[model samples]
Target: MDDLPRRPINKEREVDVNLQVASLLGTNGQWDVTKLIHLFPENEVTRILHMQVGNVHDRDVWAYSPHGSYTVKSGYTLATKLKEAEAVRDASEFVEVLELKRLIWKVPTIPKIHIERLNTRGLELDTCCRICKAAGESIEHALFNCTMAQEAWNQRSLTDLLTAYLKFMPDETIPFAQRKAIPWILWAIWKNINMLLYADTQESITIQIVHGMNEEEKKWVPPLPGYVKCNIHSNWRNAKLHSGVDYIIRDQSGNVLHHARDALTFSPNRVTSELSCLVWTLEIGFYFKDIIEAVKKPNDWPLFRALLQLISSLCARFRSVAFEVESSASNQIAREIAKSVLCDGHFQSYLAFGGPAWLHQRILREAAPISS
Candidate 1:
């Protein structure tokens, strides 16, 4: 009751401090929206409604760590982040700093080039860019500002194009097709720099970038004989709007057995959206009970906890069903199907026996055997 936000206009109103959480729920076991709005602020009410209710009793859990259990590592990380954030005067500046750190970690390059990491090891080394010899070899210099790196990006015609587009627009606003080569280009630049420094080998950046892109273009593989592979993908736009879930089931021969597209009402976030999709996938698994029984078998928040239990129970019914993660390239069709509902403004849910009519050709192309 102390933590709950009260309605600003009804400051004088009294609330029952002894009110039970169950009392806040409607007969259908969902948050009572009318009651919540009457007692709390609109924003707080929305947060309450978004929470998933479960049959288990509520208990205290740490918020910082996954599985709701706290650890010294998570605690230290939180403290360090809080200390860093406290130094920043503006919230947006803190967010930008965090984003910069995330970008630095995402660069798939040699760790030794980071001056801070090298300094922490008590090693005194030259900080100049090994290739260009003009600027210090910080992450920014090594990845973007160095002469060699700039030449590679320029060679791919991505320097001005990406800088101009990304400055004014969000990453998602740019089509993935146009920006897919950027990562490979950066990887090639980093690889070239590392080779020049350590291996004394000079590889052509253009050739490396082309080779990496070609390797990543591998298509999806089919399941083994007598087994079915279910490729699932989820699209979560925001907490306020509905999210989409798409799952396609295919046999060993690469024939689409069944597929579904669902527009879920309560996504809230990506984790919840994907978890909901997993639960929905398991529910769909019930339909293939006969096929699964012949095969034989194996093997989160309160909402996540409940979903995990449901998944375990579902797995028990099957003779042998395993979950494997595939890259976005391999599951491109499923990803596209999931994105279609949100993109086309079709909020309805549907299940079909074969591949989607609109994507039939693309599906056939994806299912085709690769030529040697």
Candidate 2:
């Protein structure tokens, strides 16, 4: 028999050293401002304390001040209190909460396209959808809000699922966590929808949800309510989606936080031709949307105006390609009017993008807010 070598033993107590380090610098789970400050040297801490940026309070300094404005819980707005009601439907807040969740989870879930930019530029283009060329794409042009997505949602029984899931949630007034299940379910359904639209061919949303629910149930500690079906139709191939609008939102470091497809269509028949033409034209406009989102700041008004002109040119191009009709003279006039309004750059970015550009200009002219 060959001689066996003795295994060396660890005598330096590496595990104990690691524990000591963990105690000094909190673990990932316990990470917060105090935990972060403890890792810095006294001089560095002092420097941070002295660094002031006007009235904005620094959390590090505020931590030491006994009478600081920081509170464990902030007062809830009337809107916040109302959100708890299950029956109240506030689309704006729902979108905001979904965005907030995406931020919190560091997940790319919401569709945050530049609606203003898309409206300006996607007015023209000639690109056919790879899967289906019946329509092109733009911001307000995707699955959640558009017609094609509505078809898919109908096919997948999304409305029913959402309704059932929502029933289990706290109304508009409920806390986010209490209402989290529905959003999660919707998110999963949306993901499956995207998979069908982008990766797979002509998949039924219902089948995808059934399969998804099954997998989700296995992973859940306590299973969710809806039943999941496993046996998918063998003939249920994915549909070929030629053209669809999608939006991508990225962080400062160019990390994609959200991406969503608008819709996909295959119809280019005589009666539906105009609708398809309009849809396809929007693709050109999507570029402007992308630009707006990229330059998401207060000083991008000039860029926005340039985008409007670009949209007009694109729309004219698409109209020529599809209908052989000359570009709308009114659209050109609108562009000129837009330029005059933006000349001084004295408008709120949010309100500027919300209403009709002409209406916005009128408001500026009169120095008054418009009635709803």
Candidate 3:
């Protein structure tokens, strides 16, 4: 034991003597909070207490990859990112770029239009903007600089437009009627550009923009009689590593039966945050047996093995369960409720009989049927 290297209890602090991990465990094989409280901060103590203690021995696990196993592809990606970080003089700009990439995946626009750049370097294709025919056909020029695209965006630049869209569009605090049509406008511009270039047809950008905006305001459909629907949404913050899960259960008559919001810490990524939300819903007696069983065999997503197992065990209590994906507009209330943890500072977890008090009016309005 004396020959072995000692590990520090807290790396943030500099201490001459280090302690073994086993010293932190009590006689019952659980984390001894008494020892942790004396050595660590409150948040660290809480995190340590939340950790699961398995019967098996500990082993090495890779952190970079999702499956806790290192792969050459993942290694190369990490290496490239590290090299880029080292080369970039401005750290803030690099972080902003990384955040932009993360947000790009979450946007629900057409996939083809989401390409970061067009490869026109080696190709014999025309490099000028197809619509304006003035500037080079880069992503920025095509999306924002072109005369037609500028008209669609009201002459806003890409940075300003994206910033405004991300700030107000997805936020529930912004009234539905007051939200800008940035996403749809951007989509229409891309779509029209594609049609003109590929099909050699000139379509009215104004007409297409109107159609795209109207599509987002579609009414939510209720489930069939005798069946209930569950709408779930998760809000994740990358910087804080915190997540919030909000879910609403409604009957065929569009009446909300139950709603809940739970905040969690140390969520690794969006995928893990979503998986945690599903597990929370199941643990609270809202069974999704079909979906749970389907994901129980974690051959591909080994990072979620523990969560999947918990879900599988919970599913055994129920005979049948049904689930269907709900549109972002339909699930808007639930999504907002989840985001309230961060926005409204409601960080604590709670299971409520109905929708939250702050969003009571919005909930009532959404539950009502649209008069054709």
Collision count for each candidate, in order? 4, 34, 0
- Rank order by TM-score, top first? 1, 3, 2
Q: Please say which candidate is ahead in TM-score: 1 or 2.
A: 1
lDDT of 1: 0.72
RMSD of every candidate to native, in Å, equals 9.6, 29.7, 10.6
lDDT of 1 by residue, 1-372 (tens): 122224333322786767777888889877888878777787777777776675655666666664455678777767766766566645665787777876976787664556556575454666777787865576778889998887777666677656775563457766664477777877888888778777778888778877887778867888887888889998898888888888998886678888999898876667677877877887877876731211122112433554555566777888987876677789998999899879988778888898888888877887677322
Q: Report clash pairs, candidate 1.
A: 296-319, 296-320, 297-319, 297-320
* Candidates sorted by lDDT, best first: 1, 3, 2
| lDDT for each residue of candidate 3 in 109-213, tens digit (9 for 90 to 100) | 642344332342222455557777874476677777888877766643334636676666677875564355566667777888878877888777667766776
Off by over 4 Å in 1: 1-38, 56-60, 65-77, 80-135, 139-185, 188-215, 288-303, 370-372
Candidate 1's displacement at residue 249, Å, is: 1.0
lDDT of 3: 0.67
Which is the winner by lDDT between candidate 1 and candidate 3? 1
Candidate 1: TM-score? 0.62
All candidates' lDDT scores?
Answer: 0.72, 0.34, 0.67
> What TM-score do all the candidates reach, one by one?
0.62, 0.20, 0.54
Residue 343 error, candidate 1, Å: 0.8
How far residue 341's Cα lies from its native spot in candidate 2, in Å, is 58
